[model samples]
Target: MTDAAPSPDIAVLLADDHDLMRESFRALLDASPGFRTAGEAGTGAEAIRLAREYRPDVVLMDVRMPEMDGIEATRRICADPDLSGVQVLILTTFDLDEYVYAALTAGASGFLVKDSTATELLNGIRLVAAGEALLAPRVTRRLIATFTGKGQPAGSPRGLDEITEREQEVLVLIASGLSNTEIAQELNVALGTVKTHIGRLLNKLDARDRAQLVIAAYDSGLVTPRSR
Candidate 1:
């Protein structure tokens, strides 16, 4: 009998201005299981071109680039209808670059510090490829610290008025860094119920992942850093 087919490797594109960083990441991904390096790019413009060419599962984007910045590249990639399946993960020098928050706003799935352990980077790629957001508590905290009190009016995403009150509560809890299980326990609802609410929130807000939902909650003034 024929053997069952093997799972396909998660294709990744490494985008950094430095050749050393790209080579290092490619080595790590090559040595790991369930991963394959699709290609590499030294500029944001090149990253965009390679993204169209390779259509990788994830793009590890460095924020600072020579021509265009990583944030702009991320915005273009995310905005492309043909590249909907691609997710960008920002890499920076700090735990969170001050601009990392902006990268998230530009449609990156999440981020990793340049010094992250190999395990962390690999897991982040897997999570993003599997359509799960890579937002950890620390990432969420960074986002909150940067954009929570600019006095941006609520309902910035254009459909906030349509969400039910319960959905709003769930969004607030999400921005506060509560996991699905935690939200379920806090609301005394079944976990499935929480998932359903989040699904609806995603649809109404036109957000691709929970990271964007967190941004929406803050932009809408539904949950503020001071409040959390």
Candidate 2:
């Protein structure tokens, strides 16, 4: 008996204004296993349209698309109830772009530096696709540091009323870029307890993932960027 053909499960949409950039990403995905390119979009408008058409597992969105910016695209994608399963991973030249906070606010799951190594990029894609956790700790720290003002994180942190004191503490550490293990050590609790707090935070805050948890913490003003 002949076996059926295999299909890559993680469908990815590449959205970038640059042809070369899209081609590069396509090549990388082509070479990697368990991934396949669903489609390509050279503009934010196109990205949104294709997102609805393809409903890929993840969209590698460039922030500076021609007709529409990725932030706007991300906002639309995230807001659309039909595209709930799709995750947007912002693509930018700098790891700590001024748009990182905006992208997160607009509903991006994580950031992907264009010049990142293949391993890092692939891992980021997989992580976002899984919706398991925040993409990167170092990048998360940089984002918080860049956006969160000294003494107080930017924006109005909301939904504090819904969670307990310990959950609130976990949010602060998450915003501060502490891993679950690190948070466990700092709080002198088991790692599973830290995970439980995060789970509660995610549920109470209506956040999509750890990335959104950081956003919520900043909005709530629970954590502030450390001074240099």
Best by TM-score: 1
What TM value does model 2 have? 0.88
> In candidate 2, what residue range of length 10 has the lowest lDDT sum?
150-159
State the displacement of the C-alpha of residue 206, model 1, in Å, after optimal TM-score superposition: 1.5
What clash pairs does model 1 have?
Answer: 154-220
> Cα RMSD to native, each candidate?
1.9, 3.2
For residues 1-228, what per-residue lDDT tens digits would candidate 2 score against the true structure? 899888657999999999998999999999898989999999999999999999999999989879899999999999999999999998786644778678888889888777799998888889888886544677777777776664444555455787898887888888877889999999999999998998888888888888888877766666667621
Give residue 94's lDDT in candidate 2 (0 to 100).
Answer: 61
Clashing pairs in 2: 156-219, 157-219, 157-220
lDDT of 1 by residue, 108-128 (tens): 998888888999999999999
